[model samples]
Target: MDAVRNPYTPGTGRKPSALVGRDEVLETWRVALERAERGKTDQPLVLYGLRGVGKTVLLTQLRHDAEKRDWWVVQVEAGADVGLRDLLGEGLYEPLSEIARQGLGRRALRALKTALSFKASYDAGGTWTFGVDLSGASGGGADSGVLRTDLKRIVKDVSLGAREEGVGLAILVDEAQDLSSDELTTLSMVAQAAAQDDWPVLFAVAGLPSLPQTLSEAKSYTERFHYSHIERLSHTDARAAFARPAQEEGAGWSDQALDYVVAESGRYPYFIQQFGQSSWDAAEGPVIEIADARVGVARGQNHLDSGFFRARWDRTTASEKRYLRAMCPGGDTGIGTGEVASRLGKNLNALGPTRAGLIHKGLAYAPDHGIIAFTVPGMESFIGRQPE
Candidate 1:
């Protein structure tokens, strides 16, 4: 089989040939966007899931869908190094500048310009020069270095300008769990202003399962945000997502073959694509048999360990890796921090920073008090291989 003809995409953040089991969420956001634009009701949407659950893919797809309706969409991400202010400055630069030049709300525009400037550098013509007509629209926006106090006015202004254009602003933030409390507050204030003024702006954030807890520490009003907890696909949806892409490429899957792929992949989208791709490549003819799926699953193990699992493992510190590997023996759900401490021969109290560090790295998360699990499934097996 030609590599170019492979229908399954196992690459990071790549959209699959078939997206299944998420129709409800897609439709839900659609209705919410429509209503928000009409000033009926609005709430920020947060999609929480473990790694490889396709939250990034969903966000990308949603942005595409919204853009088809002529909506203004901005995709930003908070990462290991990037802060929320810089991410906002980068993602919102164009939209803020575009809406400002139209002059819908003059004062708000000035305030937004100032706030963004604080996020950027003074040498860059006073923070984030939005080129074109905004070359001189730099000063008098938000006071320098005061992001929280000035955020509401800037957002109110931007959303108003967006409403005037008849298309709203959609901010998609990935890895939002990395955001600080103050950063989350800045976003909350924007959402509050939008609801009060009927401005058309909504945030769609995607991050780990711990994100809701992380956001709650900032404001109890997070209940105002629509929460979507992404889980594994159902048996039917997982099978369809497993088969449809290869079927479209003219490869047929036997009933047993499809079942094996689905079961072995545990309904995780990333693993399904990995196993499916390997199964397709392993088959001699157009139809994939059970033997091919078995071999594919075997071959796919190395692919997954070397690729997906390895990425997360490589990001861990030596001490963090020890903590995660110790976690493996406990089972898939999670391991007690006490057990982890015993394995590491360290005091539980001393291990607190290490546990927190792993969570920050996105390698693992705390599901409950004194318990933690890897953010990605099957990490136990991955840790066993080649002795990390």
Candidate 2:
């Protein structure tokens, strides 16, 4: 078998040949999109999980599925530096343009543009003003300011326009935990306004475990999101994930070999693909042997180390690295706050900012009330072999 025909994709946001154990989530989204198009209301979605769990991949797949159903979509990955307004503006450009041409009035169209390219200014009372011209007299409310009011207006226009075009509007956001408080509030307002008008607007956001809390803290109403947990695959699905691609390529996998790959990869989708590719490359004939899988496992470990964990490790500062090194003993799951603080010889309160920083950087997360863990799987192992 030629290597060029490998059916596995293990890179960033790449959809693998067999997207195993994800049919339930995908089907849920399919129904939501169909219902939205039919003017039915549903709570927006919030997808949360650890790193390398296929959230980004699922977001892309959902967007593709929506496009197939004649829905209009705007998608973007949120970041620390990327403000929500600008992020939305960048992703929404083509969709908004299409909607504007579909028949938005001059005023609504202008409002959308100003909100897209906002310039901040502070009034005498130190309140920031965005110059958003809402048609009504505004004293002061959550929906008053520029980003809030105008973002709502933008959604109203886009969703209504999409309805006129006989399609639904889906806002797919990845790395959504990085969104600022203001940005999150505005996004919630947009969804609320669309719901009120019976406009078909759907929001699907993917991020770490804390995403729902972040969104809700930004706006209490945001707690209503329908959360979908995308974690590792089951043993049965894991074996099929590796076997399906090899089978499709006219290659047969031994049960022992498949078992080795599944056990070594421990149900992580990316690792499963890497192991499959390595085993396929190492195979001498049509059948993948246990020896071939061992070689693939070794190679897969190196690949995950040098590529996945190393890249994230290289991005942190010295203090952040130390903070992570302490959490490594916790392994894939995570370490308790008091334990990590004791390991760092600091108070738990003192390490709050540093801990929060790691979460903000997407390097780690606090899965429980007082426990911290790296976002990537087996991150502790990567940290254990480090110099400091």
Candidate 3:
């Protein structure tokens, strides 16, 4: 039979088995769940990393595992344009309403029904809008802080009510770095209050490398949140990632093909998936050989060149694109900021805007010891294909 089509995706979500090299993340999630179950009211947890490092996949897996254990999970992504009330109204209130409608007692259900109906007056154009006036039954007050506090209380009350039904609450937020300073502070306050009350509320957040510090700056109590920085896979795990999928499909890979896949992927899970999928497609028969590996690498490179990398590359200005081409060859060993600046013949300060843009786009990352490099393996190849 032909090898299985690559179910793994770069920008989209996939399963743990479909994803390669995330054992550490899985274990961290398991420990967090255990702690929550034991009633340890420790602070919430944050999973921070560069984009394409499998943070999203890890969180998705955690949500699935939490559900299997009967935990009530809510997921939200804080976008650049999303605001505080919008998030609270949509992300928090909607879920609480659903949970209440399904299982809460008549009194609790009535409370929710009252709140939902009071808020319904603001619903126009099919979007729920909250007014600045603070006299409403939903607790809108002139003071922004008071309004935020009331919203937090509402969410906490709903969460506590759910826990009484034997379901722990977990709120998973992605792109957390995009949250406004006020919103971050509000969330931190809510989390701290939940912990103090011994409520079964856990937060799992994923964002850019700067997220932890941002959270800390938002609230001093946020220092208690556990931090997990997702990294690329080890060589051993990288090899297994390539082999497992082939074995699962009743197809096999030759020794040379395996080595080439690992070397080319540089142990990045997304890159490994891309390479494995392309290689399996290039295989002549059930067994993938050395020649198949070569064709697969070429095909994978072409796919990225035209699709993944090109989409990001085409969005930059001319000078920014030039800077990217200068930094493409370092591979696993990335270039220092000074070295990159020198190659571009521009002062480090002058290139700051370009560097920031690249980082924001997830095309580059800061490795340990402050070295900046490509976010994905084989990205250097993609950068080279850009017009100089």
Please name the candidate that would achieve the greatest TM-score relative to the true structure.
Answer: 1
lDDT of 2: 0.77
**Most accurate candidate by lDDT:** 1
Which is the better candidate, 1 or 3, if ranked by lDDT?
Answer: 1
lDDT of 1 at 53: 90
Quote model 2's TM-score. 0.87
Sorted by TM-score (best first), the order is 1, 2, 3
Models 1 onward score TM values of 0.90, 0.87, 0.81
Candidate 1, lDDT over the whole model: 0.78
Model 2 pairs whose backbones collide:
none
Mind giving the per-residue lDDT tens digits that candidate 3 earns over 211-271? 7767877855787788888777888888887888778767778888889888987777767
> Candidate 3: minimum summed lDDT over ten consecutive residues — where?
128-137
Answer with 2 or 3, whichever has the higher lDDT.
Answer: 2
The C-alpha stretches of model 3 lying farther than 4 A from their native spots are 1-11, 97-101, 106-151, 217-219, 326-352, 362-378
Write the residue-wise lDDT of candidate 1 on 1-388 in tens digits.
Answer: 5557888878779999998899988998899789867875478889999889999999998898778776767788888777766676567766566654554444444445554645553235544554434445534444355766555555555555556667777889998988887788778777876777777877899999888888887974687888999888999999999778877888788999998999999999899999988988888858889999999899988899888988888888888878887887863688899998998888999999988998888878888778888888888877778554
Which tens-of-lDDT digit does each residue in 1-388 have in candidate 2? 4789877788889889988888988888989888887898677888898888899999999899988886779999998887776677567766555554545445444434443433221122333233444344222221334777656656666565567667778999999988888787877777776777777889999998878777777955786678898889999999899999988888878989989899999788878888888778888858999998998899878888889888888888888888887875774687898998898899989988888888888988777778777778878777776775
